[model samples]
Target: MRTLAGYTNIMSAKPGDTVEFKVSSHGPSATFSARLVRLITTEEHPRTAGLIERDVDAAFNGEYPARRQPIHTGSYGYVEHATAFSGLEDFTFQTWLWPTLLGSRRQTIAGTWDESRSLGFALEIDEAGRLTFLMGDGQGTVSTANLPTPLVERQWVFVAASYSAKDRTVVLHQSPRCDIGDLGSAETRKFDIAAVQGKSGQRHFFIAAHKASASDGLLLAGGHYNGKIDSPKLHAGALSIEEMASLASGAAVERLNECVSAAWDFSIDQGSDVFKDVSGNGLDGRLVNMPARAMKGYNWTGQFHDWRTAPHEYGAIHFHDDDLYDAGWSTDFAFTIPSGLESGVYAARLDAQDASPAYVIFFVRPPKGQATSDVVYLASTATYMAYANQTLIARDPLDEMSMGSLLVFGEDDVFLDENPEYGKSLYDLHTDGSGVCYSSRLRPILNMSPNAKYWSFGDGYLTGWLDALGIKADVITDEDLHNEGESILAPYRVVLTGCHPEYVSLAMWDALKTHLGRGGRLMYLGGNGFYWRTAFHPTLPGLIEVRRAEDGSRAWSAEAGEYFMSTTGEYGGMWRRQDRTPNQLVGIGFCAQGFMTGSYYQWSSGSSDPRVDFVFKGVNKGSKFGDYGLSGNGAAGQELDRYDPGLGSPRHAVVIATSIGHTDNMVLAKEEFGAMHWMIGGTENKNVRSDIVFFETSGGGAVFSVGSISWPMSLPIDNYQNDVSHVTLNVLERFRDPKPFSLPQ
Candidate 1:
């Protein structure tokens, strides 16, 4: 496990901008050294410029004391100003819950309890996973009314807890939405307590969790439940069983106006964090850690699949015990980008006395209107955020099978396995088995470590290759393109993408399309480019949302009625489903994928096309090249894409090369077929291959695509003298020329 770790406040910044670094150490008072570096390649491959980074002088390059910062992981709703719920002598709390987990740990249902003082009432699942009504007097005494039957997992249950000061009596009700014929039944559990004060304090109320402590308007809570909660209500009086049943049976709040204290309708704000208490008491609360919203409520019908259409049916919010939106760490140090700092990938190198050196990576962009070079490298920051802190290889068994090899675990992977509070990737499932739709970079992401064998580090090979070819290019990220749009690309004549620009937002797409329309040349040196429809949080930096809707080669599928993103209210899925397939933009879309060894590409008939003569100028006319390199031993491996005119590939697009000799594990994407069949594996399906493509746009713009994620990895083979490097260099030099591309009639 790593002894030291850190993250940046922002991933991309301008030359004059300031960025903060948040660092943590396992041992308090530990000393560490820090410095700045411009990273070119982060991998230690023998065939490449291994672990290449240039030292950059900075003022903060000295020793400093380190401290450990804790991350509190959980999602819950909080009502900070809960004065209306204070000093209640006779009260009732009820809600509809769909429990996804039970029996392991105690789970809080709604409560005003403070664990530190033990001074309030709480409806919680006891240690034995049974519903219980617990109350504690500020002095010392505590009382509980426990139900005999433990709640069933993943089953909907309506529960109520009522207390009456008249007789010191407490009533707990657990009513399942459907008949619990054989599992267990506890329609009512009533008991009288002796010497129990049943006092309530000024402690705030919370849904799905209770407070452990509070400071600076921030809460530290525990006992987080994993499930869906909907239509939680509180009443002024200790309501009878029939009254609580009426509320649980979907009775209108107006009908019981006299007793209603707060009826929190979760359907009020689907996009925002705060929820509404519709009982007119003006009680509103905000959600912390960003739980899965727009969940199907208990009363959901099959009529509508969108929350915008039938919000009432999507009233539930699914809370996970492991949901982490932010680490909330204090910034340990900061650096202001110096004037005339070239645009590139940079990192703050940290070294502790007893640990390996750590690198917290960030991108430096050129100042506004200060384009340093004619070429720009568009970093896939959105995709990096989507894959941040991924734990699939360790947590999921299917991943090993998909890779066709036993999984390997490094120190970072082991650390992530032991520490899930760091956060999850879009490809991971929540503790409740629901797909994670939101990913934030406000925490340390182990997978994005500069030396880690993940997407971001793999893309570093291209940066190192550019340095070898003596190409000066400005660096910009997806966030910059999304926020600044086409103007960020207007200064650059040629734009080069990373190896897997998978997640794309609407603004990024529009900017790229606009760039192409204005005669901007794009070298799409990537596969699976412009695939998943993605969104950035409008108000929050370093956060993104993606939903795996209907069909895709996905780890988990979003629920039926939850295909829209809570970040932007846009439909979440592949761009193909939206009729904006990647082929329409780059002449190729994702078609096949494999994790085994890679294969080489063979020249196709279109290689002879006069339009692509410049692309093959210095390359031999042999059938096979790019058969060896770092990634899977070849250029065409990992996720592959193909040109299909039917899927919006331009009719004028030419296939320069096609990959061959893939293992059977390489299979066609799920969206390519109506149902599963034998003709889906690489051995059987002709479609399971990567196709190198080229095409021209209406303007002088043109696109050259290498439809394989591993294509760029082949650049450093034979010390950058390989065929893959030659072909890439050829295209870059031609695209750099001012001559406009002409349409061949």
Candidate 2:
């Protein structure tokens, strides 16, 4: 346990809406103090500067005690009924499965057993990858039988277990799917035991897991199944081998002669949590933890791409042992944002006597239908959620050189590496070693704290620069823009975005584009903005889905034919690949990235153009624009963007300044090349540089892009007197004017 950590329910709340904080500590009992403080970016480097917090006399401020809480990972479905499987003496259980993890672990595909009491039956994959069937008698005894052949990983196979009470015998069978022949041999095993009566208790039917006992009479689900499971069926009587073969070979349930007690058809209810039983028994089950639905099932022949258009081709539900849609933890504390509270970044600071301090960050929006200032700052909550609780320290080379020499590793980084159960970012892999495609904000996001430096350079630096300049600005989150769309931006004259606003949902993207089209001014303060095409569930809040496909900087690529999101049924990948490139909206697109260090930007020839004289009114033409800052000690570094007309940069867009002197480590983005080679490095490629761009939309709308994630970090240097700050302030002040921008004729 790394100390105290927590996360909030929502990123931004309007006045009168309640916000909840869920905090978890390490010790048995911990004393902690909580207070509301507004966060401003001072410096993100842990060793050099700390987050500047302003005490806000809000409702929460006191010392309290809290108990340690546990987090459970994995997803499964279960059917709970008083008489689900009431009086069945001889029965058979069968399912089509594609196992991802088959090495040495007991995984239950479908079971009606309670391990603590040793009763009921379970058809499971044993530790040695062989099919095992266990039938427990009313008394504390169990009859077990195992198939002779072991199963292979990631291969479709049919498995079944049947018991005949009259004969006192159990048969287990396993065979590979006909489509992918030669995967495994068809085998069966029989076992004889003393005659025992089938007993019924409080045990419920579970798919992908079984009930296991824990300390203090606590019952938890264990033996979680990994990979895909489709059309699990339970018959009232032992079915013959010929009948089982017909069912496995795509026989319709209505045509089958066997009496199915409960048959779950994952193909139905593609949009809901309910899995219907087509056998007409009405023994429907509810999915737990929200497993991936509308996936490609075993019989899928790749005839159609969209699941909605071809439902049968996508019947399987991919269930992972570590798939988490929510933490479901009880709120430790709750407070309503006061009606008069200022709109800014605020957090509930938690300090403990025996543990490290933790902060649950939240943003308070201005009063509904009102704007405190003409300038509104858009917090990249989507990006924050995408990188929530990122375990980069454990996955990446985080030494001083890899993370830049100035990068500082703090205790929070070590804590996340040690305690991975808190959850992981979409960039991480699950316990089964499969790529994590989904991430939710319902759990405690340890990396989104003020004391954390993971993504602080983006949001923290922007807020701190605003505070130091005494700029009065209202704050809104990415979720706010996603939910409300353009109406949210209609109240303000100038809208500003934070650093690294990369992960963008379709709704958010449409809203921003609509705002720009309607003559709304936008100042994109970071690079790599609007990169990935993301999707948010219509009903599931705090959950965003991403499918890494077609190319961009990514940890893993989505499997073939699986690039579409299961939530919205939309194709997932980079926006550029979808024909909505970032350059179209922000005047620049992601170009390159170098983690080692930063460089300075020089004024381009277009900076002296009389048409854009107002943008650089106070800055010197010959002087280097950005040469000093907290992050990397310079303005342009980390991820960078460049203007390219072929990729959708407007014909009238101008490159006002460009970063120079980037090291060879800064390589061109993968999307820019046809092949990977040494020519992609900044030392050889001219396109591997951040281009500060400016463009005007129809009806007086204008966009100013910094094209670098480190640009805002250079604002606080020299008491905010640097040319970077001067140029940014000039744009903001001019953008706030009610007069419509007039393009030179």
Candidate 3:
């Protein structure tokens, strides 16, 4: 912090090394300005430059003192002499620290007071997110063009640049954003400066943003809060440009919530001293609302007791059609709770299927006197609309063996492939599915099981599996539920389901819609459930229906490939898959199938970040060293189906490869991590296919759906007999029960 008394010292910086710096705070009283330099020499006076400069603006709270000139700095620039010095070409680039995913990410300087803005200032970042140094001849000054990346978001980015013919690239690192949770922008590039080449002279450095320079390299772009720059860093030698960019990728893939979990034991037995245990979900499972399984004398009146009442809000993440939903993405987890509930300790269990050896459990205890908000509800299928439309079904006969069961909707009607944007194919275009797609070299998470119904989203035999875990979940028919869209997923810690729980009634979807908005949690056990845009019977109030594409096809017709260049190698935009901007809401890219049993899995060796990966309990650097390695499946480390084809940067999403397979298949993977997370992929059972994904939102609730259903029976019941089932259960268990401080014990 030496005041520049006219002379200058190079400080602790070398030609090829990085150093922190800033302009000395003494400009108004002194006639000279302080500046940083690339180098200082004797003959001809070598001058240091390569740094950005500007007058502090009113933005970022920078302002000129009364009766005094304002200090200027807080930008990046390169050292360039243009036509003023020797013909030698030499230039340096310096950057400012910018956060990517948190806080006021953009840099600001003083400006004319902005009445519209409370702070009276504006915010900004380099256009492309990166600056460049172009040094040639008389036309030599450095020209910085901002480069853009999908994951850099809006934030501050500091960079240091130096040029060398051997390797023309500047070295830089993306710093941590507002929170350690967000990884910063991680891209870096190299630039060759032809302006300051081998010029032999004593180079002098100037700063304090003196007068504008005609020969020194600088950008004319305006600033928000132009003020004297604060702590700065300078680097000698060229930094690895590519490495820097890789870092930004990490921030892009980070997830906000670890997971969520919830469970309840109804135990609703009456006429006994233990009547407080309303919906008797007995500790061991003997007393659920099992019409036939429970003792005849037990009363079923309290089955819904103690559970968060009707019309609950199930928090969920927003899912724009364009988001990445396949393998390996992350986002926020949220859901809504109903307005009326007897205050009690509640836990949201997040069971992330396929994530073995680790799980997440988050808990929430409502205020001591909190009451239920309102009755928000939704339908699960179009047939449910018939019931909501006032059509009623005869009560099931509790006395005789039930010949016909009530359709969960309580009415008679059916939804036959009714959503206009629904795209129905045996295979997913994003991955190599089995039929009706291009580059059919291999299947991508395809449901190849021969016995499955054509595009059917269900598989039988989920009871044994559900009971195996001792989870006292209700098996209410889809139509049995009601919703106002505001009653997301009321009265439940998390909405649990079997594999292939597709065929969502419009109300069911709307209920989920409310859950996410209100901050509920969700966990999809299987694939391909709730992938359509069905209609909730507004008139019926609680009925549900799907809107068909009107085409002879199975209602679904829009394809991600048709609307995006993603099918090839560039994922310019995939959100069109569901007509939503995924990054804005959900965090995944797409859904695929074929992650196999006994596949490999591993964690990134990049950095020891426990927050993003505490789920890897007991696993470490040396453990499972070869787990996520490249496999015979080229897709393990690279692209599988090729939609949005090219490798998405770490920022937008990351392939936390767990296992590789033949035909470029990575049996396991993890993707986007941020305010919201989308995990959508598929599987097949009995030759039928299904898919389900989780969309978590900013609040802390989520929605779980899948395209496949047969898997429930495959994994739930067979887990004891096979490793795949065990793995799936383990993963889902964790997702269903996430932890806030650490992985559940």
Candidate 4:
């Protein structure tokens, strides 16, 4: 467990903007000190500058009281309409449910029952996974009626419960939508009672969970259900067995509309957290913790796949007990960026006397419409958010096999294993085995640490190298480029990218394309970039969504009809699937991947091309230049990209170098082949290689791509005197020049 952990509300800010930090401390000391630091590279390689962080004095740099803020996990919908059910004499609740997983814990389908107060009624699945109807009198008397058969996982079922004060009876009904012979047959149970209480002052009615407590504006929920719930209806009078069966079987309930109290249609607001009530009682509710929307409901058929086309068929809302969107932690301290502060990477350094110090990373951009330098580094913050708090090392069963070595667990991995409430990356699966499509930066992310491996920290090497070379470059995040478009980059002559910028939003893509079209230069120093189609929430900051549609190196595949993101209602998947392959912009696209080992790039035939002669001006005439490095022992391993004419690689693009000598573990990407075979491995396949390419665009713009994630990792080798560093510097110097390049005939 971590003694000190925290996160910032915003990942990037401009001058005069305040960034809030929320810290959680479990140490014996209740006080912690906060200081501001300019982050360079934290790589500990002996050949590199180690642990370089320049301290910046700040007004908020002092001791502050620390408190433990717990995270509540789970997603549900709740409506604050208790007056609708106050002093009710009769009632009925019905819903279409598709259970995914059931454990010893009870799962509420719909309820007003408060577990602590033991009040109201709820339709639920009991601890044994059987359908049950529960009622509480608020005076300590709780009653439950259960069906004999247990529910089958991953199957659709219709359930209903009713109470009649006139008859002093309670009734429950369960019916499966599929064929299961006797076990899946319809069931109805009735219980005789002297009296049934209908008045409990619980303010909120919940779906997929029941209230445990609501104190000080904080809601504590229990009995979180994992699965889909559709077309939930509540009535003011008891519904007969025939009436309930008619409602569940798609018969219209409008004939008896006078008794209708609330009917929630999840498909109404597919992109927002609000659920609309179709029954006209104004009993609308808001979803908590960001449940999965745009799901295929019970009535879905093969006719239409997208929810936008057939919303009625896709009314379901999939809720998971482990769904977490925000930590909701209170701010411990906030620092407003002082005017004229250089735009770059910064972090809040928090320290407790007996605990490990924590660094919450954030980026600072130049003031609006201002340019601090002629060059800019576009930080891949989208990719960082997509991989925040990932647990592939601890939870992925095939992780060791994929890496060709035993997985190593760090302190962060252990902490994530113990506390899943911190949420997971898009690469991970939810508790119910569904792909996690949404990610947020509102919670602590251990992998974003300056000292952590890969992810955001991997880019620090380039920044550190630039600092050492006395180059003045401004920094902007993915969000800034996305929100402002090409205007943000129009002021800079050159743009640089970090390693592993795998996630690309449509806005960011358009901006980069526009930049290249307007005589600007781009240095794509990374691999597997602009591959996945990503979306940022239109109204929510620091949140991103990605759906793994139709394949291309994925941890989990989205459902067939669920390839569209609920955030922007855009199709989610690889950019290549939409005919926008990365090769179209950078002269290369993702080709292959391997872990913990890398290879070197050999001079290709195009090295003699006079157009790219400036790229190798001061470099040695060696056949290969990136033979040694810190990451994977070489500069051309990990995930690699290659120039391919068949996949939109510009015909005039020069392939100056190609990586060679990779182990068999480095296999070709799945998208490269339709059939699986042993020949696809790096040892047998010629396609599994990285290529260094250069091409000139219209308007005198140009692109220089080093198609390897390990390219920057080789910069600090030999104290930044290596061939990789020299070649990169050569390109940077020429790109920084104002000379316009003529298109090759």
Candidate 5:
């Protein structure tokens, strides 16, 4: 490869073109990974000019002054410099550097030390023009020791720690080499110096008077540095060749900088855009070669826009393109932002050129509590999707199978399968029948307005959810889902899952998980929503493990006969099931033997909790959240709703309101008895909301199960209702507006 900045030339090459790079070491010690190369440009950041700071920039040594110096602004700074650790190996020091707006002494972020567990250095300007690190007086040992060193001034550093458990040692090496042995003899002390932190409960982890905490990892301050760290680093243990090489070559340092490369083949759109590394650091890059990121190894959507908006007041529609998801953007191929930019919220345009409401942020402000965003984070991983598939596909005919409105389940089309009874509901968007019988039946209803416009692009994704929620998150395709959470999901209050949102990926889970852990609320309206785990290879951004089932169960396997459970992490392990339990992390429980064609009972207070007792809400005209248990809807509703209804052949499910006689299957193992199934993670299940009178548990999640297959349909749409109280309104009231936000005399 060329220098870090040269990857663009490689990316500009057409298919079958060559991409090359070099990662050689010239220092005494060296460490590097093939993954460290990145090509930076202004393409990802349509609003910014150049890089502010790069990763792996901070460096320290006894070279300048032992004391810390503030490196601030314009993309390069040094920070948190101190006498970190020193021992028989070498004394070590570390700091971070960043670029700023104009001229400023504050870094976008700074490092924090466990002063209690670290050796503090003295920062003093000697008579010469050099910065130095000095301890107490001590006529001490001979020779020298090793220390920390930056590749150069203003470079960012991931982390640095040093220790000198041994007393007699001294030596020094400079940048590119990062070593230090001795300065001169030591003298006596005015006071005793502190030691560096060690692992576990060893004497090494002891705290010093320097003021420190063991876990002070992130410090979002501001500033940049004009100097470099001198003679740093001392390890608690002996240095092996690999370890020495690691420090020398700055292996971790490269990661600290965010490596990118034009080295991989690019066929499809990997949702390329600008992103932030850990410390307000940004990576600005994209997959210029269009065909490389394809799903089926073909670049068909090389032109369409996924969530792009109109001009003018349509700011929500800017900067996004219709990302070419191979057939569908599986979680396997991810769109990545390069490394070495400044910290801040950078926009990521995966589907369009204009900055549509869809984007990603790296340097976002800390959310006060649960960060709420109107954007939806759909799952991409085959594994998670498979999990959801198993849960949604196995339902009783007459059983109520509703998608969690607030759960953010799979897409609107998943529930439209061509199962035995209603398999015709499923549509093939790529083909001529995506709207299938459902769309054909509703076409007249939709066209009733005379000017009802047909959806020019894909399915009814936009109007289906956004119009219902009344919120403004654009329905993103598989293209822009990866980097969206950093900027997109941080603003909305709720994310809704569809009838059978079974296809979920890993990063999508992480983003959503982090979003919820931060206190966001979720409404799992459908069973087996986001359930699988999948990843994108560092090089391959398009080719995913496309799946099909022999028995039509919708369950995916590696090759032929092999199931997802049988696949390993790298070897294609699809979905990892938590287990089966009655009490879910959310208030939803699942079983398979009920919905096929049976009587779903009148939703009564199955337990003692008054909040969950459907009757407590008072039986109105039998809405979705009603106690009277309405069975169906209009002919249009029935024709539209009577499709596969998804949830086919679920091996394991948390059956909420199903017949007791059906045998439930989760992990594909044959079972002779009725097993209580469950899932893990999140504390939303059985949550006690402020509006709800008491703590309640449905199955798992901040959830409420209608215990029927068609509750979503029965739930009133807009102001139209099947009864007096709107179905979702009744449910929403119990959770939030119990007393009603509007009260009049």
Candidate 6:
């Protein structure tokens, strides 16, 4: 509630790189303070239950005065043309609406009015789910009319409201396009007021929101609509029920009438922000806040599966009350990373007088040509960006089942709900109630900060484990690997990935594959790695797009004829659907997930192979490899991946260990089933186990997959001397050697 907030431009920066910070304050002038800190561990797990922070000397630790900044939220289109409704005795307004949040207090579908000034006209949904029309007479009196029946959310409906000033009467109609009879209704009423005329002159006309007067003399949004609206038409005269039906039935476009004042067609400029007025009234409007375009519209019949194939079917734009495409704030300060600083995780902690503190995290990498270490940790930045400031607590009801804790709410989770202006993740839904297909990292991602538990484990565990072992390793991000490709990993002997690297872009996938192909070593220390096939916009720096097309553990499925990304026009879905399953690259593919408890890994048949002797240097062959750990209280739980030859696992791949004793809470992923039955849980099915796999490429390269998200949490146990730690260190030490892997003849 304090009012100061900010975000950094980039997630990570190399030494000698300049980073910018953008801050905003809602109150009067306030001073801000910032410092550098390295987050060690804040895991609430019983095994690791303490907050730790390491300070780093920074030049900018003093306070500086700053002013208030604007925050833009919601998406809609607006027209600046001024017109007086007072002159017309009879006028009609109609539009196709697809409401996402019908239960919200109030929402505007389309209106040429200002609510604060109490003038003009508007057709909106009231708090009680009724369609209400309001007209102001400029003299101070406002006439109101309402429809009897409430509309359903996420359904396409044609809504029309008409006002006859001569008769002082108003009529409202609601007609569902589909055969859902209960969703359609109509009502008519007469007001006692005289002929009401709108306040003449330049008044605002908007689709998703009405204008409200603010203290700064700026027009702020009021009753912002969350949903899709199409083909808003304004007529100079009231039309009959038959005429309204014809307009809603697609006949209005073909047979133009003299009563039509303006009809805006949203299908013309599918990729651009400009909306054209097909009625020839020159009332073209521009889209604000970047509402999702090229979506399946009202006339869509599901004949095609891709929007590019049939552009007409994808004319709708999804608007969300929490949709924030950009912050557009000015930079408050900037800092250049010193050339001598080590490559690791760093944060800029901001403090203000009597206000809550803030932290902007970024990773520091080695110089361009510098290879200071034999090992490299690949930050799962793409996955981090995908789940940035997610609002799953508001939507998903199975929080305890998903988060593995009955009291799983964190401070960061509460912050996201209080300030929705930070925007939503791809796991969220838009204002129109459709799944969010795109996510951008250009804003502050509260959960991505140090010590913040995302999916039951934080990235700090991996970094802290490496620091405890006194290992010198470089750090690189998913974006760096994406842009630079294989060349970025060519210098490092071994690469380590963080927990839950589930989201992978096309370029990043090829880079890792190429690195493995040419004698490079990879350690996939997480489950559900390289699962979703994602795309990054070429021009848009920090935005990523995903389409949850065919099977997987998905929150929401993409609608038919919309499985392709609008940003890059490429097919989106699981990599397995494209015949490039993760088992082919890292020796394991996502199989099952459970959050109740974690189990331990047992030795597999391949563990007896003499060629893999170096993997168990300090571990007992008879004992369970990972019987104790931090995550879920064991090394294998949450989500587990398995090696299956039928799915694309290489013939030479060896499964050194497999987890056992998973509870009934763990179930097989949807993609693993062709038909649904009861034999999908870990207790019923043998496939719901993580396979610690090891395989060598033809060019002396190798791959090792831990196959569980909790595996790394087991590394910091016994002072880093446990069996899990031993096996991982053995692989890292041997993989870093200059000698090549000795393949059997």
Q: Which stretches of candidate 5 lie over 4 Å from their true place?
A: 1-488, 531-552, 555-590, 593-601, 606-608, 611-701, 705-709, 716-719, 723-725, 733-745
TM-score of each: 0.96, 0.95, 0.28, 0.98, 0.31, 0.86
Of 5 and 6, the candidate ranking higher by TM-score: 6
Local accuracy by lDDT, each model: 0.86, 0.80, 0.26, 0.88, 0.24, 0.78
Candidate 5, TM-score vs. the true structure? 0.31
Off by over 4 Å in 2: 42-49, 178-182, 193-198, 213-219, 249-258, 396-409, 743-745
Candidate with the larger TM-score of 3 and 4? 4
Model 2 C-alpha lDDT per residue in residues 381-443, reported as the tens digit of each score: 888888887776566564344565554556766776666677778887776666777788888
For residues 416-455, write the lDDT of model 1, one tens digit per residue.
Answer: 7877788899999888788899999899877676677556
Q: Cα miss at 290, model 3 (Å)?
A: 36
> Lowest summed lDDT over 10 consecutive residues: which window, candidate 2?
42-51
Error of 4 at 736 (Å): 1.1
Task: Residues 1-745, candidate 5: write the lDDT tens digits.
Answer: 1110001111111123322321112122222222211112111112222222122221110111111111111111122212222211333433221111212221112122223432223221122212223332122311111232212222222233222435422222122222264232211111113332232222121100112233334221112222222112222232223333355445553432332211112111222311111222121222211111112111122232221211111111001011111211112112233232221222221111121111111121222222333334232222221221122322322113322122222222132231111111111111211111011110001111111111111012212223344533322323234434434455544444433343444555555556545444344443333333334333334222222322222322222221221111222232324231212222332322112221222222323343344424444422222222222221011101110112221222222222111112112111111354442111121210001111222222233333223333333333233331243445444433223111111
In candidate 6, the residue pairs with backbone N, CA or C atoms under 3 Å apart (3 or more residues apart, or in different chains) clash, namely: 86-197, 227-432, 305-561, 320-431
Scored by Cα lDDT, where does model 2 land?
Answer: 0.80
Residue 241 deviation, candidate 1, in Å?
2.9
Q: How many backbone overlaps does candidate 4 show?
A: 0
Candidate 3 deviation (Cα RMSD): 32.5
The candidates, ranked best first by lDDT, are: 4, 1, 2, 6, 3, 5
Q: What lDDT, from 0 to 1, does candidate 1 have?
A: 0.86
Point out where model 1 deviates above 4 Å.
27-29, 179-186, 194-201, 215-218, 250-256
